[model samples]
Target: KKLSRFGVRSKDYYLYLFFKRAHKSFTLLFGCLLPLFFNAICSVITFGLLFLEKQFRLLDILFQIIIGQ
Candidate 1:
């Protein structure tokens, strides 16, 4: 096969297998953590916004701006 032409012999085949298994687990871990990471980031942003709104009355300012009051 083309692999043989590239000097990838049977002796080194186990390294390829090891890498394949490692890649699979890495992919699975990333897939599982990616959503959790995104959710945590979103929650932090939401809580920060809520804190700012409470402290600064951001919504009241926006309402006043909208009503020209």
Candidate 2:
């Protein structure tokens, strides 16, 4: 496990460990991938939220609508 260097009780290990404990069918050979996946997912979600805020701002000007005022 590439993530063997990481603390087993931390976020990545706990998530995978729970999966194993529950006898889940799927497993990632490299537990380190969980942190990478979590970060990537968070980034995408944050970007989407930021983009929506900007889009609403543009809509506000176009439609003469005020938001969060």
Candidate 3:
């Protein structure tokens, strides 16, 4: 009832309702997906480092492995 004071008509009121529903779902979806996004980025970086490490000399790789132990 108070919505009419701002000139919001009955027909366009559904648009506002739709946005209210969409905003809640969007927030929930973003919260759920954020961790997966971070994990994917970390995995990509780890794989890249491994690939670069493979390009080094075999002796260097062995040295690194020995030092890591």
Candidate 4:
């Protein structure tokens, strides 16, 4: 009876269907990859800063503000 009141789905109807079908696989993949991606970024930044000089220039400051650094 209530189904007849709203005779339309939504734009995200397919998304809801996908979640119903493949929720486990998607969550498992994300769980496995998230930590690896974060660690890779952290290691890269640490490695560069470890070997680089510690001097800061006016240009560096300016570029940092401009580029949201």
Per-candidate TM vs. native? 0.67, 0.50, 0.55, 0.45
- The true-versus-predicted C-alpha distance at residue 43 of model 4, in Å, is 0.5
lDDT of 1 by residue, 1-69 (tens): 787755666656778888999999999999999999999999999999889879778778888999999
lDDT of 4 by residue, 20-63 (tens): 66888788888899999999999998977765534346667778
Candidate 1 regions off by >4 Å?
1-8, 58-69
Candidate 3, pairs of clashing residues: none
Q: How would the candidate models be sorted by TM-score, starting from the highest?
A: 1, 3, 2, 4
TM-score between candidate 2 and the true structure = 0.50
- What do the candidate models score in CA lDDT, each in turn? 0.89, 0.77, 0.84, 0.74
Q: Tell me which residue pairs clash in candidate 1.
A: none
- Candidate 1 CA-lDDT value: 0.89
Q: Mark the regions of model 2 whose C-alpha exceeds 4 Å error after superposition.
A: 1-28, 65-69
Candidate 4 stretches with Cα past 4 Å from truth are: 1-18, 54-69
Ranking by lDDT: 1, 3, 2, 4
Q: Write the per-residue lDDT of candidate 2 for residues 1-69, one digit (tens) a residue.
A: 656656655877789788787664334434667889899999999999999999988988877754444
Per-residue error (Å), model 1, residue 2: 18
Cα lDDT of model 3 by residue, 1-69, tens digit: 686755666556788889988998999999899989999999999999888877666768788899995
Task: List where candidate 3 sits over 4 angstroms from the true fold.
Answer: 1-13, 59-69
Question: After best superposition, candidate 2 residue 15: deviation in angstroms?
Answer: 26
